[model samples]
Target: MARIVDVNPALVRQRAGAASEFLQVAEERLEFIRAESGESAEAQVAASNAIAAGISAADAICGKALGRRANDGDHRGAVELLDSVKPGGSKLALRLSKLLSDKSQLQYGGYCSAAVARSLAREARKLVEAMNEFGIRS
Candidate 1:
């Protein structure tokens, strides 16, 4: 079972708000740094923020819909929790899972290419959008 954090409505809004802020940074910085090489630490930062935003978006969705958020070391647990929240939850889970799957490589691996960073940012954006569709309104 996914470890979970019981959340109130205020916490749900807080997570969604955080997700929006992280996404804003990721989107703005990504445009300017997209041309930079993957070795560019700025690009990596932007990508890292994107991944953070996606995670926050997932938390917001689950918190709003299920009154709980996944709190597990394995991010797939987050994905699975999201999967059960709504009809479109699985799609949101897929996006979140993709971001999580790439996290180690993008953030910790030797070099994060601009291409990979861009791809991750795109997925993060989609995940945030899905939060709105799922009624979290990030």
Candidate 2:
């Protein structure tokens, strides 16, 4: 059984800041796919993965901040992390939970669409920005 660890506020804040940076970069890549490409299927898939990675990383940091261990298993891990964070609510967490759940569906089952990927990325950006608002600092 995995256990949640109580982390220092300063460390949590630092982790949140790091997660925000990574997520920002991921969002940028997703946008680059839009600006550099014509929203191709490959671009959409790439964007989806990028955002997923960003969310995964972001959730991991937030989870740690909130006294949870965001592990692997994608969506399941995300949900567990959210639960660890008290009431478990955040736009980024919600969006990520959804996307992480269907990532295999998008990648293997070909459900990834340019519009959907872009939307997910946008949501993730908002979440990361929100984390910054929560006193995350370098």
Q: In candidate 1, list every pair of residues with a backbone clash.
A: none
lDDT of 2 by residue, 25-85 (tens): 5555555454442445655555565555455445545644565445545456555566444
Tell me the TM-score of each prediction against the true structure.
0.89, 0.60
- Kindly provide the TM-score of model 1 when superposed on the true structure, using C-alpha atoms: 0.89
Mark the regions of model 2 whose C-alpha exceeds 4 Å error after superposition. Answer: 1-18, 31-42, 53-61, 83-92, 107-111
Best by lDDT: 1
**On a 0 to 100 scale, what is the lDDT of residue 121 in model 2?**
64
Task: List runs of model 1 lying over 4 Å from the truth.
Answer: 34-38
Candidate 1 lDDT by residue in tens digits, 33-118: 74665367667777888999999888898898888988846687799898897768878888998889878887667657677778
Q: Name the 10 consecutive residues with the lowest summed lDDT in model 2.
A: 83-92
- Pairs of residues clashing in candidate 2: none
